[model samples]
Target: MYSVARPCEVRWVNLSQVVGLSTLRSFLRMESHMSRCFAAILLVTTLVAVEVPAVPALPDAQVYAVGVIPDLRGMLQHTSQALGAAGKTLPPGMLEMGLGGMLGDPGLTKLGNGPILVAAGPGLLVPSWGAILPYADAEAVIAAVSGAGLLAEAAPGGVAIGSAPDGPGLAKRMLPALDAVRAGMPADSDLRVVVGLDRLSQAYLPMAIAAMQGAASAPGLPAEAAGQRKLMLGMVAMLRTFAAQAGALRCDLTVSASGWKIDAVQALRPGVLADAIRPQAPSTDRPAERLGAGDGPAVVQMHGCMPPRIYEAMATLLQETRRDPAAAALIDESMVAMVRDCAGALTGSFAMRQGFAGSPMRQLGVAMVRDQAKAKALLDGARNLFSMGVLADLMRGMGVEMVFEPAVRHAAGLPVDRISYRIDPAKLPPGQDAAMQAAMMPTQEMALAPTMWVWGSPSAEIDAALAGPRGAPRLAAEALGAGWDLYADLDMALQMKMQFALMAKQIPMFAGAFAEVPCGHPMRMAAALGEGRYRLVIEVPVEQVADFRNGFAGMQRGRHQPAEEPETPAAPVF
Candidate 1:
């Protein structure tokens, strides 16, 4: 068996395998059992040894941060022991048929797990994680084992997992990067992320600029290309200045069921664009009450800010980007138009839910739009470019006719889930009855008119469908479980691979040399600030956290391909 020079290491004989394989064989053959007595006579016993290491705790942050402490050695040892014990009891002919070879060299399994430690700050201002594998130390042991021919019988080539050249030098290079992440970080910060930002702006940014400049200066370029190039150059300049001002950054976030908000603070010095879009006092507006016919819409209604705060912030940013008088004038005109026509003070959603209770009958009411007159005026004025009289007449027709009540209860014996669809008329100012008739005409299953009385119980045809498919409920439960698992696996794989790919591009050699990459489990929630480190706290939904033991067992079973049964021994040649 291969052995490393760990003086204080303890070796554990898998007791179950020893009894099931070795003792079972001994009991079957008297001579073999006697041979073991000779082996015991020749053997020399030594003192037992034990090695243990301390486990580190995670950092304390004000908000929320996930901590990861991976014990690579322990994991490898446990996995190897399990595999070794399971491999010992193969049938007589199976070992000769390369089944033993497929199990791998249990004797040569002397590798230790490389542990990783990660500490994060609240909301991911700066977080650092690092691992150092003792690869250089393993080379010495490998050389010794080969010279002594220890593993020649066990595994001719020996197990060469994660064998890399210049292991010490590569590790030396990486350790500095780990240290650098913490060096300049604020001691006050619970977590810190130190990036090679000078390289990003001063090096990569210039390279991009040069490439773009070459493209712009190329011959036979279109006339408008020059203007586009100039604009791009201006944008790049703004970015460079922005990067310079943002020397180091920190972020914090607040998350709730409603949504999430991120507040990022950057250490800044003055930049041209920064001055242009300096922060202003937040606006004060009484939260506008839901404005419309008071709960009169039949189906669904929603009211909120017409232009959200994010849109306003974007407009401000766009205005700052205008660097010339003509550009400023164009933006001003656009803003004026937006405020006058598009940017309504309040917006609402209204849908009239009208159907026969227990019948496939439905009627869509008018939009129940507030400020309908103002909307009519805007379109009416625009008709001069085309024709105003027709639109004005149609608007008048819409205002006069339809009225929906706030709430209408359905009759009993209806399915809980119901479908509703809108009726679109080809011609404007069509009568309500005409519109409703057109909507139901395609189906020809229900007879309904666009009248006040629409909601009712399900019709006989629909009632039969609701009562069908007894197995549907059970099938749905199974589907939901399977769907959740499939989606969770796919989501986890995709997200991790994407992040790894990004990391690999920057550090090719170190990342590309990995033997087997580990994909961590999915996170329920995560938040990020503009082009910065993703702040994630592990909040796995209870339903999604597969039981640790069961999941591991399932994975093991999944990976193992089933082999044919061993042939029975011949019946002593009859």
Candidate 2:
């Protein structure tokens, strides 16, 4: 009778005990599931706020910064542990990836139930996000992630924001992978990660490495022992001679107010050009068959990289050397020795292409790039920017290859047929869109700019857009013409490649064919030659777009440096 009289007190004691045990369980469960932030707050809260119930976060638009997501299990594990420790409730359908069938070691069970918005790990800065980049660090990154999560809490009003960070160049590839995550996740998701200022060095070391691989080349060995020995000895000698040039160097990564950025998460396929370019004519080292345009346009962070003209010159040199025996002879033993030395330099150094020769098959790849002109131009230009040794250093700061060709090919398609591309090497970067009223010339009508090419976009939509009031022709009036350089929507280079390869079947022509290169389509050709030639610079398919605008603020400010801006949003609809 005494115990029954104290029913309310007994109930309170049981509830408190249950709450304590549950928290303990949550802590224990999520302990090893992450890089593990210190749960100091949770501990303090648990100790001091015993009677206070946890309040759910308000529903609001959210952005997510997804990172290093491997398996669904890991995802669940992270979510479970975080929520459990926080003692917060999870939104509905949060655990559906199926833990039973998922790999071993489930993460944490939900601490409670509540609504949440999801974002992925990787992300790119928006138009002006780069301004605050330097301020971001681990704590800042965590806040961005949390702030993004807040944005994701709202329903039916979300979209992912990112470009591929995981394409091509492996070591630093972030964009292609970011693109993949951006694509792979639900359309409503926004995956992002902006680490702290403290982490800037660690984050960008990989950035440099990814960029270097595409700009440099390695030596070729003649497969025979004699050939290998020749390359090795010459390489050793070269290293001894140039040893004085080797020293510690550091690069200051300036946070450009000019919006200087690169999504290096993907760089050029490392040494793919060195080992696979010209595989057909073993001795001539020219193409026997057109290597199927090896892959699609690899998303790369082209930081401090050369304009397309440099590559064009190198390609020409390589092609000339391949077809002409005299030119081949011109590449004397010394040059050959130099090539071997460059190849050798890869060893004990950061040149990613060095060890590739060790493979039996790779050794046979004496000439990865068949066009001697191209090779020479690239090598020559590379020589001036810095010696081979200095180049090795420069290469280190380049970028990473995120997603390889297969990954890019499998990712998605975007419709871009109706675009009027303006390849202005000297064009300026556009002024801030936000300040349009103030920035615009009072009399001139501002134009609509081009949108980014994403997975699932097609050119037909642009073509269809032309039939409307703001058609291609009207748009072209602004995006095209004399002063402006453009690749008139036709894929001429691709056609020429197809035409020559089918009719002549000549290896030289096949190798020279434009379609054989990555991003070979005329529509997306790299920077154009100053003037003239058959490069993909054309007027638009659209005839009239009063709203067409230029996106070149670089040109506006008279900044001569070429800038490649990715993930730009669609301009105002014409």
lDDT tens digits by residue: candidate 2, 1-574: 1111111222222322222223222322232110011101000000111111111111111211223222333445444444443333455335642432121112223211211222222234321111011111224232343343321111121112222322111212232333433332322211222222112223343454344322222233122222222222333333222232212111111111111111111111123221222111112111101111112221110001112232333333334343434233222333333333332221100000000111110100011233334334433432332222322222122210011111222212221211111111111113212111111111101011121111111222222222222211212112222222111223333333333333222122122333322222222211111111111222211111100111122122323222223223243211
For model 2 the TM-score comes to 0.18
lDDT of 1 by residue, 167-202 (tens): 222223333234333343323222333233332354
Provide the global lDDT of candidate 2 against the true structure: 0.22
**Candidate lDDT (C-alpha), each:** 0.27, 0.22
Global local distance difference test of model 1: 0.27
Error of 2 at 35 (Å): 41
**lDDT (0-100) at residue 353 of candidate 2?**
8
Off by over 4 Å in 1: 1-111, 116-131, 136-199, 222-320, 323-574
TM-scores for all candidates: the values are: 0.27, 0.18
State residue 267's C-alpha deviation in candidate 2, in Å.
Answer: 12
